[model samples]
Target chain A: MRAFRAQAAAELRLTARRGDAVLLNLAIPVGLLVFFSLVDVLPRPAHVAHAVTFLTPGILALAVMSTSMVSLGIATGFERQYGVLKRLGATPLGRPRLLAAKIASIAVIEIFQVIVLVAVAFAVGWNPSGPVWLAVPAVLLGTAAFAGLGLLMAGALRAEVTLAAANGLYLALLLLGGMIFPLSKLPGGMRDFARALPAGALSDALHGSLAAGGGVPGRAWVVLALWAVAAPVAAARLFRWE
Target chain B: MHRSDHPAISVSGLVVRYGDVVAVDGLDLHAEAGQVLGLLGRNGAGKTSTVEALEGYRRAAAGRLEVLGLDPQRPDDRTRLARRVGVMLQSGGVYPAMAPGEALRLFASYYDDPVAPSALLERLGLEDVARTPWRRLSGGEQQRLSLALALVGRPEVVFLDEPTAGVDPHGRVAIRAEVARLKAGGVCVVLTTHELEEAERLADRIVIIEKGSVVAAGTPAELTSEGGDAAARGGTGAGGGAGVAGVAGMRFGAPPGLDTAALAAVLGAAVEEIEPGQYRVADPGRPATVAALAGWLAERDLPLADLRTGRERLEEVFLRLTAGDRGGAREEEGR
Candidate 1:
């Protein structure tokens, strides 16, 4: 446990030191929420009075994806490339504990992201009528799913490839997952495709359980739960130390 | 730190394969606690693979490998075995952004009782770069920090891959001292390096491997001495003091294209300009031959460069063994 904490602290310091990752994971999500909320380019959400109400939930979900997947995966890929993972694997901490530490650090960064995004959302006239606490499970599940994918990508692919894939996927999910636009706006087939993705499920789950909607949709929760389990299992089975 | 009656590491018939490449083939290695076993080999001679297999980073295709009586190759035993072993990788095993101080502290946390990070920093001569990031540190500093990370856990056994490979003279001294300290503290140190001097200075016993198997292993004194019993018993009888040309020879570099025929006539011995700027006397065991060569060199005013004598016979022994290995390796590849 002591090893886990030390490793977690080390991983967090490395993650935080990366200027590009911070810009992608923390700044971009916050920037998107604030910029889109102030602009009228986005279609007014069906039931929500202001766009901030709709954007807030999806923005939080996006934050989870960026921190859990893009930031964590790219960093892990490079660390593995540089033989850091192999070195840690040789230690008494072992791979399982090292992995636990990495996820723990991701969770720590997610908390900071939440506090910042929520404070900004509140300042932009966003108030919730439905259960806001549901976002907790919603965010946690999203984090697990994305974090697993991140590790899977990092452990299985080359560092350069992971960098490109993580960034490319982040953009695709941002534009297609209803984080910036409504799922209803994506054409029929495209909307279904977007909804089938974990990013989409996370966006819907957060949107439904936040102030803009009442109660969580069964399908969104089920999709998230399936992904939350599948991605991590795949990552665990396929992850390599070197 | 735990006392064990048996050797710290024991291995026999170890086979490690990377697809078609047999990296460690039928290799045998053993080291008791408090012993420094120097593993010497040329590039691609399976030193790294052997170390990795023992360290539990690579699975042996076939063999019995025990570290502290635990088989590191077994998945179930890896972590348990890891608790008692420290490994220093060849390069870049640390986060580029992490400082030596932070890395040592992090690695120290893994053990129930770890050496203080500050103590390690001071010992490895890394105090000035304790706060510097790994990427920013000089190559020698990076190596010293890597060594410090391995020792921070106070492991009972340590595997250091080229610990002093690119280190400066001071860094090399620090590493050698720490290795000696580890030996005194009853820790087994298995070091693989191309630095022959390090092996000669630090290893109580040295094993030289080629094509995945040990060709010669004995104390440095035994291997380097021309009449040492190890040469008589060394595998394949390649150890017949056969260097450059078979038998005792004096080799030196002077001007290229020396008059070998005239020099041989003067010494009444076989002499040859083996390559550009390099000459060899077939039998330097005769002082008359030495005098004749010196006279000939004096007549030519040719300055000798790196003229080695008995001090470097381990290198002579190594050259003899690996010389045969190169031909065999090429034949195997050709086939």
Candidate 2:
């Protein structure tokens, strides 16, 4: 366990050192959150309810998308191309620990992402009532769902394929994921597909916990759990640790 | 039961096929303890496939293989064998992003007992680049790092596939010295290379595999003698089926008088008797002829001259033996 943790820490440290990881996973999400909240480009209610409240969880979801999918896809794809997976495969560290370490590091990064987003939300006068505890499970579930799907995309596809697919997925999920707009506002097919997509499910779950005050059991929560379960198993079966 | 005189690694009728072309065909090899067995073959002469099969990396199509007294095909047994075996592949590249020392340490964690990274690095002259990332290291440095990774585990049997493939003369000498060190330490080293000089300097026994089978098998002197033209020109019918014929082409300076009768019986009458104390057998098709000749001479206390077989360097020897087949094999494997 100590060895696994050390490896996990090392992987995380390496990721942190990469300039692009910081720019994409941290800076981009935070910058976008601040930019979207300040800008009047979106249809607003005269700045009364404040756009930051609705935008905070969505920005948090975007951060999750970038880290769990885009960043992981790019890093793992390069690792594969460079024979990092082959080197590790020869060792005693099996697939389970390798994946576990990657997931754990992302979870750690997600914590920092959440804290920063929440700080920005509070600065913008965003407040929540009736128990903040529910938000923790929602965030955890959201993380797991997106991370699992990200690993699947990273492992199964070719590096070039993953890069293009991950970028395309990230952009599409951003707009249709209920992060920028409510799902009901999207077209019929897109709304239905987004409901099933892990990113959309994560964004919906987070919005429910933070804004809806834990009043309703959201379909997004169930969707997130199901995907979280499926993507990991599929990755395990299909992942090529070249 | 006490440890019998079993081969360190044994493979019989081993075959490996990728699609239509067979990479390894009915190959047989055995390396005993306390000796370095040089597996000399050309590129695509089934060297990598044979090594991979023995290392339990590639599944064999048909063969019985025992590595370190355990079947390599069994997953549990193979893992156990792997723990005791050090394998240096020709192309298993290190992580470019990792420092040399860091990479060594990471690999060290896999084995239960590994030599200290500092000591290994120092031995391989990699101490200067210990902190350097793998990509920054030169070709020789990279080769040394690869060798260090192979030996760090302190395994009983080390299979080195082209240890000096891309190394310069200095690095080659260093690697040869390391192989000598391993041999002195009582490690059974299975070395594969295209350079026959490396084999001559290091191998206690050299086996040349061509077209997926053993083309020649014996010591440097033995192989050269068997492959020499001495027996072919004489046509003396000295010893026919002896293992010596496979490598009877290169004959070294002869020793004193050796008994011809017993030698004939051992080498099987196809050997052409040269002058006193010398015998030449030429049969490229036989793998047992050289052993037969050696047994005949050994049975009657006769001193044999220095013998050479195959090419002086494994690469030349491999080219001479398997060049014809590799061209077609390479073309087929390209797709």
Return the TM-score for each candidate structure: 0.91, 0.79
Can you tell me the CAPRI class of model 1?
Answer: high
Off by more than 4 A, model 1: A212-214, B229-289, B292-312, B324-335
What is candidate 2's CAPRI-style docking category based on DockQ? incorrect
Candidate 2, residue B144: CA error in Å? 2.0
Clashing pairs in 1: none
Q: Candidate 1, residues B155-262: lDDT per residue as tens digits?
A: 899999989988999999999999999999999999997677888898999888777877778888877765454433345333323332223467778888887888
In the range A1-242, model 2's lDDT, one tens digit per residue, is: 65477568767876887787898788987787788788846543232266776777778888887888788877887777665775465455555677788888988898888888889878767776433576677677766666666677777888888888888888888888877676767779988998888877877776766674454256877888898788767866787765
Candidate 2 segments exceeding 4 Å error: A43-48, A129-131, A213-217, B1-7, B226-317, B323-326, B331-335
Instruction: Write model 1 residue lDDT over A46-116, tens digit each, in one string.
Output: 77678898898889888999999999999999999999988888888877788789889988998999899
Top TM-score: which candidate number?
1
